[model samples]
Target: MPSMKQVTFRDLWQRFAELVHENKSVLNDLDAAIGDADHGSNMDRGLEKAVEALNASPEGSLRADAKLIGMTLMSTVGGASGALWGSGMLKFAAALPDAPEVTWADFVNALGAFVEALSKRGQAVAGDKTMMDVFLPAMVEIQAQLSDEESLPASMVRLADQAKAWSDGTRDLVAKRGRAAYLGERSAGHIDPGSLSSAFWFEALAGAVGQQ
Candidate 1:
């Protein structure tokens, strides 16, 4: 069994930057089908700024780094995505401990806080064809697996897999929130860009943690 790795906030941000940059076009394509086609570029730019913010004022604790990322995204990213994502990041930051390395419970609690923040910000629930569709269920699975005493990488991989399934499930859901709701039944076939991007975030984290 692989030993648990200590994941720093810097590691999380760097991995997010790389993954979002690499998959920007794919996210844009998904968005183009259902909503504004700028999700990819906007997220990429925001994450890039987040990386810069972290580098400029290196924080010894994960909480500080997460706050910097949240603020940077809120100020730099465009569209509603910026507000929602930034709010979620801020909530995650608030939930984290002052320590540099995060334990499994700390990570799970942070994610739970993020989900709650996002749900409140977007006023979205499950099957809303929103990122919460992916987030809510993924968090459940992550919480469940927390009892297994598995290595962090293994647990993250499972969560990423669950997130992917939930993201894909968004394809069949009619939009109940956001601009996509304007299309009503017409939105059923297209994948939700937000949910997909959220999945990418988890996948990137899993990949980053696995490498360690």
Candidate 2:
């Protein structure tokens, strides 16, 4: 979700920044045991670079924004999630040529592109305990909710609801892709950090969508 009638590069950066700001500590805690202990730092750094890139160009072109996101994440963040998530955004951004005003179809295509790109890059799917666990199902719900929507805020709230469900659903899933997979059934007790983060981003977007 975005505030403006036409989403600019700045809006994308702001959405990401707001999510990161809110979740930095949570992500750091989540990464402490299962992962490298730098998820928050890495994502914050990546988004900072993304904003810098946004400022560098400031052209409001979707393509430019996409390329900057791709480059920034690839350069700043490490590990599987960084590459996969970064590439997903990049792939979606690449599909648009200019500062095109997006519609429901655009979000659908963008989410589909994200899952497809991450699948191709990571070879994972829903229930894999990866970000795809949340992304795939949420995307499905988003498409269904927005298939006939006229108000952007309404569709975004629907998307947020689905994302919340996806985040909650991750609690019972066993990790199959990341190092957490080694925990086997033990992973089932803890919520997937990636899904939580993804849902937070959606929540922030939804909160901001109607603000303007």
Candidate 3:
């Protein structure tokens, strides 16, 4: 049987950076439809800087690495994504222990902190056509799976699928927050860029954990 595995902070950030680069154009296209058309470029730049910071000092603890990543992102990325995503990362990092690896429960706590930080920062709720649409449902599913004693990889796989579904479901939702809200009813038929990016984030996380 595949045993439970601990995830190193380096593994998590490396996968995230790779995924951001891989999906940059798609994220930009999704944003052009309803947002400022810079989500892809902004996130790419931020993650690149984050990866550089991580590579430069790989000896730090996970908490320190996460802090550097968050600070780098906040400084490098432009627009609301920088602030929101950076703040979320910092919040998540704050929730983690000062260790090189994390257990399933530790990851769940960090994920919950990230969601709460993003929600508070954006002041958006479910059905708002924001990243929250993807994140909230995934959090619920992960928590439910944990309660049932599901393996980490299995739970993450389910969370990734749920995030994708919720992201796609955003096409039917009118924007109630952020720049997309300016489009109002016009945003209904377009997928949310942030939600889509968030789906990729979870999918990459699932892939990383599955590899363990």
Candidate 2 vs candidate 3: which has greater lDDT? Answer: 3
- In order of TM-score, best first, we have 1, 3, 2
lDDT of 2 by residue, 3-115 (tens): 23335335646776768867787877776645556677777777777777777775565666777778788878777767987888889776664654565466567668878
Model 3 misplacement above 4 A = 1-7, 147-150
Q: Which 10-residue span in candidate 1 carries the lowest summed lDDT? A: 1-10
Global lDDT of each candidate: 0.84, 0.72, 0.83
> What TM-score, over all chains together, does every model reach?
0.92, 0.87, 0.92
Q: How many Å off is the CA of 90 in candidate 1?
A: 1.2
Clashing pairs in 1: none
Clash count for each candidate, listed in order shown: 0, 0, 0
Q: How many clashes (backbone atoms < 3 Å, residues ≥3 apart in a chain or on different chains) does model 2 have? A: 0
Pick by lDDT: which candidate is best? Answer: 1
Q: In model 1, which regions exceed 4 Å deviation?
A: 1-7, 147-150
Tens-place lDDT per residue, model 1, 115-178, is 9998888999999999999888888887777654447778788788888888999999999998
